[model samples]
Target: MAGPQRNNHKRPFGNSQKRTFGNSQKRSFGNSRHDQTNKKPKHGRQQMREIKRMGRRHQNEEAKEDFPDFPENDEGYESGDNIGEEPSGAMSLENNPRQAYDALMVLLDNGKDEKKTTKKSEKNTAKVQVIDGNIPGNEDEETEYGIEDIDEDEESVKKEDEEDQNDLSEDEEDEEDDEASSDPFEYHFANPQESILENFEQQVSKDSTLKWQSTKTSTSDKQYMAIGQSAPIEEQLSKGKQNIRLDGNLEQFKIKSRMNIPFDDANITNSQKLILDSVFKYKDVVFPYQHYKDESSIRDLYAAHAVNHIYKTRDRILKNNLKLSTYKEALEQGKASVEDEPELRDQSFNRPKVLILLPTRQACFAVGEKIIEISGLQTVENKKRFYAQYYSDDKVPEYKSNDFKYLFDGNSNDFFCLGMKFTRKTLKFYSAFNQSDIILASPLGLKAILEKKEKNKNNKDFLSSIEVFVVDQANSLQYQNWGNVSYILKHLNTIPENYSEDLDFSRIRMWAINNQFKYLRQNLVFGKFSTPEMNNLIGNKHSLNLSGKVKFKRNFTSDESGIGQIVFKLRQVFNRFECELPVNDPNARFNYFKTNIVPFLKEQSDDKEGGGALVYLPDYSDYLRVKNYLRYETSVNFCSLDEYSSQSKLTKYRDGFAKGKYKVMLYTERLHHYNRFEIKGVRNVVFYKCPSDETYYSEILLRFLGDSMMRDVIKDINLSVVKIMYSKWDANLLEKIVGTQRVPVLCFGSNEIYEFK
Candidate 1:
């Protein structure tokens, strides 16, 4: 019996070729087996096969129910071919080979169909879970399948991962671009000309008041009137013809209405008005006679001057930028040509233009407060942090003198530096130096930064464009470190290095480009008293202000000098030394002291009645040289004291010298300046050089020689002798210590020595 009328049909597996299954070969539980008379069934095996077929049939029925829309005969088999029929007999493989082969093919088809049904069910379930916002687990399916199915799944998963990574990288790149664009330092300027033009346009559009329309006459058009004379009033009165008429001419010297003084007219004293006027004119000014009472007014005046300068500079640049922008816009619109473009060169190498050198943090705070007041800004960006750093609530000590109390009050901590940026409505403190409009720093602070840059061979570009330089409390700086201030001045207004990309070259001023900024820069120095150092600094080549310079003159009489303050009746001797060249003055003075004064001091130390000589040297270098000479070259028992001497060493040396253990004591003026030690048991006093601060000279004599305790112990104040050494270079110091009239006789007289009692 030929395999009962075979029904031919084809079914597709994955992507491979299709396979044909006849009705006798259909792999379903309900399919009927062919009736084979020549075949015999194995009863035990047939029973197990029947049970497995039944299980598969049940699973297919459930799959059909879950997806009722799926076609029942989609696998190319008749629906009736596998429904409601049982096997008639089991075919024996040894008796009927064709029948057994058909059975094996039927099993393979059934396995493929079951896999397809299960996959469809699982895929549909996953779709439902995803639509419900439930993520599927990463577990692999255990169902056996062809190799093609596994490869397809892996490719799909890899493509999804690649897409996810690309999306994440794109997002990160976008965030970085935004950050780079927002940060001014990191932002790369593609077209600086256009960028600055736009910036200027925005500034003007936001604040209409920035564009000033004034009818006041320009300073250039006004007649130049001498505000005040530098000569002493007595001398000016002596020459009656040269005396300035003060009748109605005072109005000409009055501050111009257009000068924009921040304080009220009544608040400013009459004495400060002329100084303010001179400063407003951008002239170099030296007010060495400034008193503590005048500090506030001086600070206010300079703050206003600095603010006005910044305003004018900003206005000029913005106005020029607007003009350039308009011209370019017109050209783009075909209404103007290249020749019609405006010339707008008004920038410098960097933005900082005002430099305020203060001695201490307290002074910086005062000046910064005045600047903020003058700016009329309601908000300061870092005001809280700035106050915490510069302001102090510490109680001041009860000093013996009011001057000392005032000088030491508040946060006197030095080594501070800060940069300020000004805007239309606000002021920002602690800005980067390169981006700041003003710099407030101590000399030491600036020196430290300069030294760091020097090691790297980098130029100080921030200081290259300074236009207004103010040094307040300059005398105080002399006490701290004058070399720091000198170093700062030497590096000002120099050409920058490797900073070309940071600036708009087309808009740089011709003067700045040619390194002629020093000529236009204004130098203002204020102090309590004048010194030779201050005079030399102001008169030096660095202070070449094109607007002219003025200095206040002070004259002194014998009674007004510090020498007259000495209480003890003792003989005072002045010795003059000659030096041919100014550069060789140090060596000449050292030699003269070594040859002439050292022997006198040695003899005094050897005398039992004379006691130890207290030798005072002003310059630290001189102190060091004298110290080394006395310690190594001389056999005299000596003790040295300086600013660097610690408390233990100071105590030990003071005790040793007072008890006559040491025959000589070498003292430095700086040590006395910082700590006014009232040393006991001092007899002969010798000055290696006149002190820069004349007060120190009187203080030492009064405290050491006129001490009541020492007087009672010694009982012979007249035996104490004071000797001083000087030179033509010390003329300024000598004039301040001994009256101005006496300086002429002492420095220029034929006598090399003068005696006074």
Candidate 2:
């Protein structure tokens, strides 16, 4: 007993070994807390919660694919575990500098050597560097002027809490206390991380030096890191509400004859090289996905090298200015702004010089990264330039240039251009027009921004300087919203006259008169399905009336990537269309639904991979009819959007079918309006009705096709495409189903599986 009391397992140097930081199991540094008095960041707790939630959702997705035995109910989803998750991009993100540095700090002890090893300053990421209880940027604060900017009204919750403490009745206070204590999880909707990050976003918004710091209190046995230092801790969130920045020495953008950023040029396909050259030439060229001959991503190739061409143009302009070139020459070249008038010298400096629109938020940022990498912008002395900001649903971090940037220790005179993902919030964010350059927005995002600026009378001559306009997915863009396409076409490259006092034209790179820009932009639209209507959008693309200049419906067909003549063998379901079901006499759709769709789905109901029915109907009414038919007419496990409207519900249904939860997944094409889906690994692809637009022909097939997603997400399979062709309109889809030699094709019709002979 005495020996046990004096055990040799004593704490090292008399320090208790039991003490630990964060979870003993995970052995992370610790859950850190920042200066709450300055701004209560969502750092410690709320972030952990969101992280846990996101992890679970990812797990569920993988489990649904792997285990194939998880329950198919929405119970796990609705329990507040998985909802409102927008994937940032289709590709894996390159490692962020700040993220890598912070991760390194987490593994090291709080020894002074830790700081020395990571002493190099980073431009993009802010690190917490609290010393002697003094926080940077907090010493001058008297009141919370701009700590956080919530989407909610700008009222301060702290002031409200003060008022409550000062004037609330005793009974009211007591009742509030009881209610608060009743639910430990309940708190006001204020996102702690967002509020804390609000000022940081705003300060960093205008490209200020944001130094996020952390204080490490460490002894030999234990180390405690301040929450401020561990902030990525979280990602910038989803790409929708995200921001991006670009800061590099102008001198660094020189030519690297042999340097290629994402991939070497030799691996680049000839079609891709042609598109790249066309982009540089300001030619309106459409390179649809149909022309893809190699496995290489043409999108990456275009964005990477296109950025090089843009930089070349800008470098030429900068050198011209240095060489004392006449303002007229720079204006004629149309590469940058060069205001000669003294009055125009003081104008806003953050308008976009170029514009590119992609299909999603992630694409905007990913392309931006490629541009940055190829430009040799890996390191920079200053971090206060919000060079690139992607605007999405506020998920992507927006590059904000401080309107008060001059007041901060950042560049005030140098003009800045940000790259932002286009989100619905782009309509409301007032600073977008002033700060954006090389805008990367979807057509819908541009529409929202256009409408908001128009309604608010803040048309700041921002688009007048645009030199290039590129739409990456012209065909899919047309399918998503033809009206948005029209809206962009009507105003893009056109100089508007609604002047705003807030706009500082002098800061514009080539600030002449607002209406005096000499360049008519070159437009490049990529359309998978070539059509004359799309060509019209580029009408007079080189014209000054905001109409498109030269347009070419370039469908570069190569035998290697072509869907070969095998697709020509698609057979008509009937020897001819006979009135088998009289329902078509009154409702042609109903007869096809009963005669063609019903039987094919019934046959697939017994497949080992869960013979799930995937019906893509754009209209909600038709979705209901199919869903009802399956429910009442057959014993198939099926569900629909009858009452459920949330994406979580739809996800559950789709995932359930994939994991053997249901036999049918009735998805509406309308879901694309909210957010598109690329469902993978499903066994049967039944086309209830083919789309009128050939643009969507390949898209719809890819969505349900056995293997079109990421290379590793699902295994390749021989697909069985079930076609419902009761009428000629419906029968026309047979050609789309029996595609060319890119892959083998099989179609089920007339109670027979027809192989492309």
Candidate that scores best on TM-score: 1
**Residue pairs clashing, model 1:** none
State the RMSD for candidate 2: 24.4
Model 2 error, position 724 (Å): 3.8
TM-score of 2: 0.43
TM for every model, in the order presented, reads 0.63, 0.43
Regions of model 1 farther than 4 Å from truth: 1-274, 290-293, 325-335, 395-403, 453-459, 500-502, 609-611, 708-711
Q: In model 2, where do residues sit more than 4 Å from their true spots? A: 1-268, 290-351, 376-437, 442-456, 473-491, 499-520, 527-591, 594-638, 641-665, 668-685, 690-721, 726-736, 740-757
Estimate, for each residue in 141-259, the C-alpha lDDT of model 2 and write its tens digit: 21101111111111222233234333333322221211231121111110113343443334444653334333222222221111112112133323211111011111222333422
Worst 10 residues of 2 by lDDT: 8-17
